[model samples]
Target: MSQIISGLGGQSLYGGLNGINSSSAIISNTQFNNPLESTVDYSALIRVLVTILQQLLSQSSDNTTRPTPTVADTSNNSQPFNRSNNFNTASNNNLLSAASNQNSEDDRNIDFNILSATQRDQLGMTPRERAILHLWGRQVISAGKQDGGIYTNVLGADGTGTNWANKAEVELVKELRAAEKQQFGGDTGIFLDQLYFNLVKEKTGVDMSTRYANRPVHFSSGAVSIITDINLLHQRTGLTEFEQGALRLFGHDPLINGKFDGSVLDYTISNNNALDGSRNSSGNPIDKVVRQLLNEDIQDDGQRNGSSLMKSVITILDRLYSSN
Candidate 1:
């Protein structure tokens, strides 16, 4: 597990504190001499870690209703923790109204089932999407990252993002819109755009005007690397299904430009203007973790930065174990 956190071949993916030593060498010139013992069993590893967190969360609470453990919203809400009553049902039913209420009764028992691969597809998420949800939730809950629980963080506060789908899922909606644009033209594409905008605003209380107003809502700088890979592979041949999916997930269209749209290039003027600012509206908690992992070099400020995903994950595990 530490290998996963610290990374292999002396490349310390799990960096240290913020101010320890910014200039210290994190990796050596050993080259690829130390290959991994074997490919990491991501599925099994994630399940074990998530299960441990679930057990700890369950044990910590004495609620009569048996609330499901959820991620807290990091933006807009100042509360340390936001709870989801159950994952089987939408935590924010108000967002979905009849849609979630109607479906929740049927899906209410499906929350715990998400850990199983067989049940995963039934939840309408791709492997990557579910993996992001599982790993991010585990990082937040079990790792004790200050972003807190699943309900507010990953799901989006008031269940706007989490209602029926998550931030990852919302991102997929944008991709779907992009696909519709390619297939139907700009008018139809804008229709889909409005559809999602209304849905997100109606349910989650977030609007793009507000979300992107102060801070540019780029998922992470990692998308730049991903887009480069996609453009390179796409020019060679038709993309693989997974690759195509990645393109959509990142809001890119091969049919259009090899480069990303202005939507993708939206940059923040300052920390105050950024979506993570004091008034962030649509920053996804899971996306934050994913971005951190994908972004380059966490050691710039050294070990003092508690925001590092490695430190966050380690802190979560430590808290759960100590509490037990």
Candidate 2:
């Protein structure tokens, strides 16, 4: 209950120049100071968080079947009690009450299931694959004094790059696919990629040919700071998670080569060649909150200025059908 971000999470406690800004910040910075915390145990933290979520979801599901109890109408409690009659209305009332509470909780759980699954798929992840997407490590690379010694704007632990696992999606998929085919193949990222692609298409009819056209979809900026540490779990948090995810995506995977592969880069220049007529078929919904966050990072200039906050949400669908 200390509210400290502990264990194996990728979140850094460094306050940048903010200096001791929050209690959570202080705890995280301590880890940074200690060389022992340099190791990144992704499996441990992921398992812990996933277990907690599963337990909560199970409880919620159980609540849905709980029987509702009627409130005691105490107006007729004058009846005498015998050894057998001890099972009075009071006991019955308590049972009913408990059941009703459970039912209410179940409904909430159902809603959460839908929402979480939807968001994950939109961002390209499956139900089982939905989690803190990150290739976490203790690599704390500060931006140096020129970039403020720590990109304060880049959210998440050790800058924004350490949070989300927006690793070259295609390369990751290839690795996973190879794992599946070969004995050394690890089907982890590949299965995740497939699951995500299916979910988004089911939810939204939009396709890659329509959305990206020829444009490249970079999650964030910088050579290594493309993926946001915001995690798919909290990407819908808007100014909080939205910005963070964008940072992670672009920062970790910028269009360094300026070359766009049709399958790899969904956006393109259609025959019409117009931005306004373009319809993004992918799952990335430009919510009001997302707009606000992007506005903070992006500027309104034809020159395409600012910290290049125009981040892209790389849909997993492309990889599933990409020629590359």
Candidate 3:
């Protein structure tokens, strides 16, 4: 039995159990002889075998629970967790930011001060009043440029052969004529005021007629001259003296030495040209004239000094008469 144990490398097993000196020696010395005749310590052998089994079980448990080391994947195929979701989130954020910025820019571009009723009140004018002045100015300028009879009546001798109107007025008249041609009713008698009001409503969403129930309506008459019509307009509208004068300048040719030489329209256009060229310089007569007309403070600098309403009117005039 000892020879059989030696052949099975039992010595090596005993060498592995180094700390159990007594068990190692006993295990090494135990011999299994013939079962019927030999005296064998089965209990000592049982104790050594139990100790070996316990140590083997402990080693197996340690191996089973031990954590394994891992290396990070650096291959091209590797991607972050939730990679697609993360990319979509970032892209949506960028688009939202861009849209917000664009909306802010658009808001800045629109002049809210001009559109707001409360702001217009601060300038001592209602929106309807402002719209009336704008309409009258535009019409007078437009009528001043018409050919033949209408031109002669509106601007007098000054309208004889001169093309004193701006490009916008010319284009406006062209468009109006085109629209008139397409009308179902024939020859509606040159309703420029209607066209002007229609444009104002379309652009601003404010119907001038609704705002001022008694607003003027344009009508053609051979009995009344343009001057008589304008005087009646001032009386009916209760316009200030300055407002009346401004309207007259557009509708009438100014008399020099009791004879008409040049209209206020002529001087206004010339002065506007000078003002445009020398915007930073001072002492243009038209600037002083406008300030006086609006009863605004006059400054030496070329920069405009007026109430908000005054500034707005001047800005409209500038745009209407500008060569560029």
Candidate 4:
């Protein structure tokens, strides 16, 4: 894996991915590494994303591209992350322009939210970004009820959060922590901190730093109901070969995408029997998901035509590498 990343080191992955013929197959770019020989062609995976990205960017002028406007242009496309401290009053309205970027990056918004008031605002995340942070944290650990009403009085709000959509997925974990040994019906297992591992990681992108996001959630029931999507428990209780390999590289397990009964998280989150796949909505593998999608680049290589996403990746990777 290291060798693959190393070979592509300083190389613009977005360029290569974006360069794939827009008319060609998306799966062609997303091909994977060899499980047996560590020989994988990331191009195939890139293709899948390229198709999506192409579709997205192509819609810049086509209002009919989808039912709604491209998220960045949509005033309602708020990110699910709620790390209040880092959000700037400015990011709420405008998206960082993509002209500074090359090509591959014009895909998703990479901005991140503030950690807190006193926290040095590092990444400068945008609004939709804030939502992803919130989404990831909610799915990973149980969520407490949030008094989202604070946003209700705002200029615009969309789709009402139904009971299932509004309830916390990991609410059970919190309840279990306070439960007695006998309340569990068996030996006590799992720690509270462990429950929030990816939650914190997703929020801050610091790889499970001791510092935690301090947002408080207020439940609608007046009591935060603790319920593990029974389906999530079943899938995570055992690991798959692909999942195990991902965990080894990324340091965490992925979430269940469908229930044993074969239901999607959309249904479950809104009150079905399945857990959403552990991945962020972007469909990136859960474990390897990047935290701050920093919106810049460092490689001056003329060989590269930096796309928006490429710039974000390069800038962030460079920043992290240099900080060390």
TM-score of 1: 0.18
**Better structure of 2 and 3 per lDDT:** 3
Question: Model 1, 243: alpha-carbon shift in Å?
Answer: 16
What TM-score against the true fold does each predicted structure earn? 0.18, 0.21, 0.25, 0.18
State which candidate, 2 or 4, has the greater TM-score: 2
Count the clashes in each prediction: 29, 37, 0, 40
Model 1 lDDT vs. the true structure? Answer: 0.31
Task: Note the Cα lDDT for every prediction shown.
Answer: 0.31, 0.29, 0.35, 0.30
Q: What is the lDDT of candidate 4?
A: 0.30
How far residue 117's Cα lies from its native spot in candidate 1, in Å, is: 12
The 10-residue segment of model 2 with minimum total lDDT is 137-146
At residue 254, candidate 2 shows an lDDT of 15
Which residue runs does candidate 2 get wrong by more than 4 Å? 1-188, 208-243, 246-324
Q: In candidate 1, what residue range of length 10 has the lowest lDDT sum? A: 216-225
**Candidate No. with top lDDT:** 3
